[model samples]
Target chain A: MVKTYVFGHKSPDSDSITSSLVMTNLEKELGNTEVQAYRLGNINKETEFILNYLDIDAPELLENIEDDANVILVDHNSPSESVENLENANILKVVDHHKLALKTSYPLFLRFEPVGCTETILCKLYEENNVEITKEMATLMLSAIISDTLLLKSPTTTEDDKKAVTKLSKIAEIDVEEYGLKMLKAGTDLSSFSIEEILALDAKQIDFKNVKSIVNQVNTASIPDVLEMKDELEEGMNKIIEKENLDLFMLLITDIVNSNSQVIALGKNADLVEKSYDIKLEDNMVLLEGVVSRKKQVVPIMTENA
Target chain B: MVKTYVFGHKSPDSDSITSSLVMTNLEKELGNTEVQAYRLGNINKETEFILNYLDIDAPELLENIEDDANVILVDHNSPSESVENLENANILKVVDHHKLALKTSYPLFLRFEPVGCTETILCKLYEENNVEITKEMATLMLSAIISDTLLLKSPTTTEDDKKAVTKLSKIAEIDVEEYGLKMLKAGTDLSSFSIEEILALDAKQIDFKNVKSIVNQVNTASIPDVLEMKDELEEGMNKIIEKENLDLFMLLITDIVNSNSQVIALGKNADLVEKSYDIKLEDNMVLLEGVVSRKKQVVPIMTENA
Candidate 1:
């Protein structure tokens, strides 16, 4: 029997990684024994921290899928965010929490909500299917909600997400405040990564009308410390902009502790960022107060202004 | 406050017409008082029978939507199938039971399942939200499910649809077999329709790889009577093919009583239909035994062969 490969988007965040594992578990509980969890990209620090804390092994990396492969997507649905040759794969199901950008030739099961995290929707799925949420599953669910919503501080946090975090934390027997802060701080450690690697983390390519740009984000305890390497980061961003022929590139150094972001704008259309947030750039950088979510705050605003 | 418009695809079917009204009711129950249901095209005979039987008004026809208008789409999501300027509208939600083909700039609520009818998913929504199904709503829901599933005999019918029909029939206070047969027969009255009207009733444009085709279906009690007008129907089909630059045009004359379809294939790539179903086209037509569903039986098979 052929196995169904379940995975998230290319850059596997905590929500993406956790949703894949949770959906695989839910599918197995529903008697689909041939389902297996995989990750399209390397696990990020936040997701790796959660996996290590729960003593769960990370899903194997999926380089590419063959034609007619049975695939289930979680957290993201856009073909650009998924694995290569995704259009040829037989997508059986998609559980996502992002703006829709998918096209399929046949009818399939899709569950999408305007929630902060994909695991929050997966939590409801478990309750709807009458499957017991195990401690490990609860922990994974709680961790993803924390990572995506910035401990319920981001603007993207919905009522469903808040309720799921409360319920799953209780099931996991963990203190929400204490564990969430530690896990978030664990991901803020950028000492081991090079400037290029930091720039690559959580980078999303977006088209704003005619202007093409890449919006990359990194969570840190101190935005000033990340800005210390602004010269080198700008060099790295310039290399990417030239290679991809992007009109603009914006790097958001998000202060997870304070729930703000210090953005460094580069490329030809960098002034659009200044126009969007109504903040003039000082040396191509500006502090965006209370702007933590790239999806909610940065992308929409820039797309509107552009 | 501006009212949000809820509607379904153009050339509205029973499922599309019923879903828009049901979704509007669901939104009102959820405290969204500014939502109104509309229809993109004229209601069919089957939906007209349902509305008249229940003493309900058909939704007003919507010519077009303005820029940034709030919209909730039911039964369909593709832009081509929806109203004009759909890309300029703020799509708030979608309740559909078809293959996914939508792209949006923001995250929104989407509920899609692989059931026979969109009403089957709406039945689940009413239960999930603790909204009581009134007798009128139940009748409308039951009517759509019956029409889409061909009285629960279509291959697209799922277990959820079967259960919804049973539960809704009790609330609707109607006999399923007796009322369903009448409603199906009411739609089969083709005496009032011209050959062009019959061909345009449920015509769906599909792209099978590079082959562009239009597959149309019309229900009837007698296929022999419909075949008598094949010469005129072929003329109309040929005109549409030339005007639209189509590769093929297939007209499925479905016998609702016998659950069989007599298909008339025409145009340049009409041989593709014979190749797909492994039947020789006698007079560019063949009997498709036990094939009543265009979505489940015809589209997928032709797509695979194309």
Candidate 2:
């Protein structure tokens, strides 16, 4: 049997990790018994919380995939966020909610929508195929939706996402507001992680208009708690910029409760962040009011400027 | 109103042209009033026959698209086969039945399947969306399936294609046997075309294992009818090899009636083809018995060796 590995982006967030699990389960239900879920990075706090809550073990780590390994990608289609040696892999299918930056030589199945979360698309696919969503799976998907949409507060939330959360919450037999707040709070626990770890928590490399850039975001309840480590964070970002030969690096210290973000910009293309937001950078940092999503807010603006 | 330019790949064939028209009509039915169909290259004799039979005018030609133009692609997704400014276009949706090789910075709708013809997928799309398929459209789609699959004789044909032909022929109110043979014979009319035009009729550039190669095919009733023009055709192929800086070029002079092909191979990578079939080239020409479809037989074999 050819073992088909399913994974998400490199920095595995809740949506990326959970959607992989959901897709692997759905593929098995569709009679592809060799499909297995894997994670490209270490499990984040929120994803670990969800797995522990449901009594489900985290998927095994996949450091790198072999050439021509059959795989399914969820939550991302950007080649930079994909596993190493992706150019040689035989991508069987792609179920992503982000931008489409993936190119393959041969045809495969692709389901890309402008939804807030990959789980929302998976919810519709399950209903369309009439596959039974178990309670554990429902909880996993519901947690992903809440995390991606920030408890339905982020502007990226769609009517489809709202609908999926309502339907999935019923199947999971959990109060959405109660469970959602707990899940979001669980993700905000970043006290133990070092500055280097925080910078790598949710970083994604984006190549836009021939510009190589990296955008990293970390959620916190108190913005000041993250800003206090600004010097250390800047050092980490500079090390990454030199090592990756990046043109720009922007780290979003997002306040989850306030729905605002304080950004640290560095590298040669740092002026692009200033031009994108029309704000002056004080010591390479600026507080942008009402900014949260990297997909909805950060990427589009930075891509336009780049 | 924003006009969405819809088109297929370069070297337009029956399926590539007809599928664009069908997709345009389906989009208009779905209430997108600004959608219009276009073609990337000149229509082949076989596609022109189908359009004339249905009394439908061929779509206008498009050389290059404006930056950020709204576009919908049919029949192909490879960047090489797409429009000139496709990298700058805002792709609204893609409905293709070929390998996926497109990359976009933002999310869009993509429907790709590994079917025999793009029209087969469109036939199912129309039925699923509950849009009425007019008789002319049915005939156009039916003609495309028969052309691509060589009246269901090619190895690329699937059960879906057979079913699509059976159902579409009914709506077209024509006997499949009678019209299919006529359509196939109509495409074999290469007497009027120059050697250069014949070589450009249905050629595709494939990047396999990073090797740049070109594959061109032309159908004929008798293999000798095409082989008679071998000197001129070889001259044309040599010109293309120098102009395009190609590594290899293979032209399949396929006999539609006998289901066999005489191949002319040239360029630095010509040895790959000789090794693939284990046949020595006699003046760079060889007879491949029972080889018809390029997508199924030639490409896979040459790509493996390359």
Task: List, for all models, the DockQ compared with the true complex.
Answer: 0.84, 0.60
- Candidate 1 per-residue C-alpha lDDT over A223-265 given as tens digits, one digit per residue, 9 for 90 to 100: 8788788899999999999999999999888999889899999
Which ranges of candidate 2 are over 4 A from the true structure?
A: A173-175, A208-211, B132-135, B166-174, B208-212
**Which residue pairs in candidate 1 have backbone atoms (N, alpha carbon, C) closer than 3 angstroms, thus clashing?**
none
lDDT over C-alpha atoms for residue A87 of model 2: 86
lDDT per residue (tens digit) for residues B1-306 in model 1: 788999988889999999999999999999999999999887889888999998889999999989999999999998988999999999999999899889998999889999999999999999888899999999999999999999999999999999999999999999999999999988887787777778777888888888999999899999998888999999999999999999999999999999999999999899998999998999989999999999999888998899
Clashing pairs in 2: A106-B99, A107-B99, A107-B100
By DockQ, the best candidate is 1
Error of 1 at B123 (Å): 1.0
Q: List candidate 1 segments past 4 Å from native.
A: none
RMSD for each model, in Å, please? 1.8, 2.6
Put down candidate 2 lDDT per residue, A237-271, tens digits, no spaces.
Answer: 99999999998999998888889999999999898
User: Could you give candidate 2's per-residue lDDT for residues B1-306 as a string of tens digits?
Assistant: 899999999989998899889999999999998988999888888988898898889999998988989999999888889899888899988888676677777777777767789999899888867899889999989999999899899888889899999999989998988888898889999977888889999999986576788999998888887788889889999999999999889999888888988999998988887888999999999999989989888877877887
User: Judged by DockQ cut-offs, is candidate 1 incorrect, acceptable, medium or high?
Assistant: high
lDDT of each: 0.92, 0.88
